[model samples]
Target: MSGGVDSAVAAARAAEAGHDVTGVHLALSANPQSFRTGARGCCTVEDSRDARRAADVIGIPFYVWDLADRFRQDVVEDFVAEYAAGRTPNPCLRCNEKIKFAALLDKALALGFDAVCTGHYARILTRADGSRELHRSADMAKDQSYVLGVLDERQLAHAMFPLGDTDTTKADIRAEAERRGLAVAAKPDSHDICFIADGDTQGFLAKRLGQAEGAIVDETGARVGTHTGAYGFTIGQRKGLRIGTPAPDGKPRYVLDISPVDNTVTVGPAQALDVTELTAIRPRWCGAEPAGPATYTAQTRAHGDDVPVTAELRDGELRVTFTAPVRGIAPGQAVVLYDGTRVVGSATIAGTDRTGRPVTV
Candidate 1:
């Protein structure tokens, strides 16, 4: 339970089904001041209290589990490291794969719990052939299976999401919460980065990686500007570059890449950001690898528009070729594939292949 209406309702539903459910609200941080600054915080003491209150109203046992140490190491530190390495990382996916499904589920099993349940908007389906598959929520706009794509078959087997069956709107969920008299029925959704209390992701990283002044270069290797650090920018960033180098063609510039090793930022025309091919590592399949090379739809970021692509799994890596050029794909961000609404697989992008054909690798 994240001290939110969804989890509370999930717990209520589970209990209504005659299961001895325990509400476990993960205490993801050791900071005491972490509380509701609206509906956007989960690390606050107030959240735990709210979870406990909901557990009482639902007539179930509730406990706050401190996973702060692991969260810092896995999600927080890894985020800074990815940025320092000039790769955009999604901490939420990391938390789901490592902290929630791996750590929390393992703990739940050890305690004799049959399965771990959450309020995530995703679904697990048992195909007619007895294979379990992860599918998108009925509401595509609010679907979150994209982030949960990191889980493999084993993890999916032990997980449960009660909100995936119907295309229930957020307002409907809130109304259900209100009918149940949940205190958090009206809680606002959490916004911004959770760990960065001040909401400055760059400053939070800079405090850890510190500052290293570097030169900003154009695609021609010509120094155009300078920044305190290269990690502050991402691929395809067009604003706050604080650079004065105007293009000869009089077109606005966009960030093409960030080289953290040499501490340089590369700015170029927007077209230079287009990538026709992507080479990614750390491939994770919901089940086993595909029988062979397959054509599917893929998204570089969770909120990106899914486009048709040819994905090939070879030598333990995933190589994707887009039918049309895609922009802003960055190393270290997940490239999630889908066969319609069902999640195909996910891989952490390592590089791009601009000249590759949209064929099997």
Candidate 2:
């Protein structure tokens, strides 16, 4: 239940619908204090207690499964490695792909469970032929299909989202929780990287990767500032550049690229961040992979607007051409394709083609 209002309400609805529901809270951290505590985190000890209380109120079985090692190897370590390699990764997406739907589902199926139901704001539509298609939730403002874009066909078959088809808002969900006597009706929603307790990503990376001094350079290969580590910065970052040399035109500079190989951070004018095309790898489709090039809406960041793009699977990579230039796209993030409100697939961004300037350090 993740000790949240959404999951608690989802469990109640499933049980009330006459399904034998079991609430399972994943213990993703070996040490609870290492992760974010209280309402800001999901894997803390307090969250486990909250889940158990919710299960009690809902009259269902509750268990806390320890998956700390697997989470560390799959999501946590991968996040650090991606940052060290000069890439920005979405850890929530990785957790859904590797931990929730993969590890948890595998164990659940082996235990004779029919499905793993959650409170995610996404829908799965079953076709007449028994095929399933993942779609956005009816509540468009709270749609989470982007994070769940890694689910394949088999995963979709055994997945259940009790709240996806409802048009109610988050506040309505909280009200439902209160009506159902769920203790977490007013609990604050979790945000940011849960593992990082204080939300300082740069400090967290520095602790593990260590601080190695590097140069910050502009597009023309001129040194502008210095940084403790190249991994601390992300694409399109404007603040914290600490550039001593102001632009000759008195304009502000933005981070255009991060080169881990050269240990340099590249900054330039905002327009230099424009990207025309992108190449993405590790594509995972909700159903069968597309056979040819097709036009679809591409969403890069979570909660970001979707833009029209032509995507093709060539040489085992997703090649996407945007109708309008996209800025702040970085290597290692995901590009989720959508046809209307249905999620087509998602791929990890490997590289991008800029419009006017090079991304090299």
Candidate 3:
């Protein structure tokens, strides 16, 4: 259990369903419980206590599993490496892919458990043919299927999301938690990156990446400003350029690219961020691949609009074309495709058609 209202209620619901349920709180750090300072974050010492209390209320055995070494090696390091390479990563997705489903679920099966259940807001649909498919939650606003696009058939088969049904809203979950006497029922939701305790992503990167000064150039390659590090900037960022002078066209400029190898940041007009096509690498299908250049709704970022798109799979890569224009398409971000509510597939954005083409200022 995650020690939040959602997971606490998930355990209650599962236990009510008459299955043999046991609560396992993941200790994702090496430090002991005394070291954590009641931070408003997941996996803190306080959260473990909450999970244990919730498990007690639910009448289930609880245990804290120490997976600190594995998490640091997998999720934390991958987040740092992706930023160092001038690419943004969804560390939550990494945690779900590597630590939760792959590691935790695998160990659960080894210990004779049928499935691993959580509070993620995504549904699992099982076809009559006995194949399991991941689908968007009935609550579209709370849907998290995009982040879970990394799961494959094996992982999906052993996964269960107890809070995915349409009738079960966040309010209902909290109400259930309160009815069951869980202390986290009314607790505030945890936001921001958990590992980023201070919530300063740029400052954290600066400490690790260590100030590689880079020239901030416009589309014409003329030096317009300077940045402490190329990795600090991301595609489509309009703020924090700190340019001393106004643009010649009196229009707003946006980040077009970041070249970590050359240590340079390129800025251009907002129109430059627009694109109609994308090339995605490392495509992962939940099950078998579809037949043709099929049409599906595509999402580029979390909480972003889902646009109509037609995509074709070629040798494990995807050539995706949006029916309308998309802005700020960044490499290393996942592009998830959906056929109605069901997840069609997902891939890491590799490049764009205009990757090397400059946006003329």
The backbone clash count of each candidate, in order, is 2, 0, 0
In the order shown, the candidates' Cα RMSDs to the true structure are 2.6, 1.2, 2.4
lDDT tens readout by residue for model 1, 91-161: 98999999999889999999999888988889889989777899999877778898999999988888888
TM-score of each: 0.95, 0.98, 0.95
Per residue, candidate 2 scores C-alpha lDDT tens digits across 1-361 of: 8999989998998999999999999999889877887899888889999999999999999999999999999999999999999999999999999999999999999999999999999999999999999999999999999999999999999999989988989999999999998989999998889888889999999999999989998878998899999999999899888889999889999988888987999898988888999999999999999989999999999878889999999999999999999988988889999999999999999888899443422
Question: In order, what lDDT does every prediction score?
Answer: 0.85, 0.92, 0.84
Model 3: which ten-residue window has the lowest total lDDT? Answer: 352-361
Q: Which stretch of 10 consecutive residues in model 2 shows the poorest summed lDDT?
A: 352-361
lDDT of 3 by residue, 1-361 (tens): 8777888887888899998998999988787442334546787778888889999999999999888888989987888888888787888888889889988988899999998888899999999999999999988878999999989998999988888875677887788788888888998776677777667889888888799778999988999998898878888899999986678999989988888888988899987888788888888888888887999999999778899999998777898887777888877788999999999878888776553353211
Query: Clashing residue pairs, candidate 1?
Result: 34-44, 40-190
Candidate 2's C-alpha runs over 4 A off are 356-361
Model 3 stretches astray by more than 4 angstroms: 32-39, 354-361
Comparing 1 and 3 on lDDT, the stronger one: 1
TM-score (C-alpha) between model 3 and the true structure: 0.95
The CA root-mean-square deviation of candidate 1, after full C-alpha superposition on the true structure, stands at 2.6
Model with the higher lDDT, candidate 2 or 3: 2
